[model samples]
Target: MMTTPARIRVAIQIPPSRADYAAIRRAAAQADALGADAIFNWDHFFPLGKDTSGKHFECWTMLGAWAESTSHAAIGALVSCVAYRNPDLLADMARTVDHVSDGRLILGLGAGFREWEAKEYGFEFGSPAQRVQQLGEALHRIERRMTLLNPGPVRKLPILVAADGAKALRLVARYADIWQTFAEDDAFSEKSRLLDSYCDQLQRDPATIERAVFVDGDPWTVGTRLRERGAGMFTLMTRGPDFNLDGLRRWLAWRDEHNAQASRS
Candidate 1:
């Protein structure tokens, strides 16, 4: 259903937690070298898994470093919480990273969810609706600030919004160039249809907004289903410690084969 970027893209998400920075950096470099379209890290003050007390690294700072280190992959947080910093500040930070990466930065954003992280960092973790509202407001401010910045971004920095609710999907239709969702196949298909409807109401072409999904499992099974549902970008996640990417080759192979078929068609 989408019209642009006909080739399927595969990315790697390296969780910046529970491992050494050296290991994280190596994983990112390897992903970039492996012809991955993008590399991502999550934004969290702490680990989200069972090892809640494990070590973690911040997002944007890591991105700045990755921008300088990796040669070919676009990089960013999978979804940076809008509550953590002022929108203007985040915009400036993104602009700087865009320059650092030579225009390969994706400014992924989301409504803040973790209550405890908010309390720990002294940020206001409002209700779900309130957080989505804040995200909408922040998007406006970020856009405005990007225009007002002295040097400005090297390119029109892509904004990737990760959301599932109707209000957030409405915002995605209005503001997002990329929409990343973690819903299951049925739910994702339903949400994708809802997004298309919202795009029509907003008078925007749905093809302009790329659909991205966090993916795992077999490429020919779950991957094929999501691709059929109009997902163009598949993100494979690797946590810290080992940062295993042994499964990436299979996805890359699938990506190449799929793209080849798409091109011929």
Candidate 2:
């Protein structure tokens, strides 16, 4: 039961798969200019779905570029895999990006689930429980590193945890400023209730954690329903080739209307 905001904010995830670096950069900049609250990219080494071997750029590298290119929207990985890099190094990279963006960066992290990525990169794939445990340790190390780094982060960088499992939810309760997941209908409601229970047990005010979810389909029909289900941040995924903004435009319009109503109230 997080404190609901009057207007729902929207993020757009521009997948780097099968697209040129120039196209990806343009899409991110355009999304920011079009009033996106955040612009995100995934942490996979290869393209997801259809063309697994397609041209795909690295996540953190693109984020660095986005930091300098976008003027308004916060930029980050939709969720970076904890297994991919050393926690301390990840923290430093995030800190640098924060500086580059002038403090507009969200550090989104998760226990990675891609076996191919680990296998190809020579990193340990590990079991789900093991990865979750690693993620917890990584979170602790990241926090410590953020403090130890010279000059430190531009601000107390906001951490977004992407998780749905019970163990991961506990970590989210303990550390996350924003909790993100992809669920809908009854499953979405149930997961949210479980998160609230975790917050209560941890003596945390649920309102302190912002709720986010990935959205597909029409904003007016689907987005409103998700907002009602306690998702304040809605993220839409746009794949490359031609990073479409038509849908994003419609959602931004919805956001504007919703916020205006809130102001009146």
Ten contiguous residues with the weakest lDDT in model 1: 1-10
Measured against the true structure, the TM-scores of the candidates, in listed sequence, are 0.97, 0.97
How well is each residue in 158-249 modelled by candidate 2, as lDDT tens digits?
A: 99999999999999999999999977867888888899999999999987888999888889899888888888999988878899999899
Q: Which stretches of candidate 1 lie over 4 Å from their true place?
A: 1-5
Shift in Å, residue 242, candidate 2: 0.6
For candidate 1, write residues 165-187 as lDDT tens digits. 99999999999999999887789
Error of 2 at 60 (Å): 0.8
What lDDT would candidate 2 get against the real structure?
0.90
Give the CA lDDT, 0 to 100, for residue 130 in model 1.
Answer: 94
User: What shift in Å separates residue 140 of candidate 1 from its native position after superposition?
Assistant: 0.4
In model 2, which runs have C-alpha deviations exceeding 4 angstroms?
A: 1-3
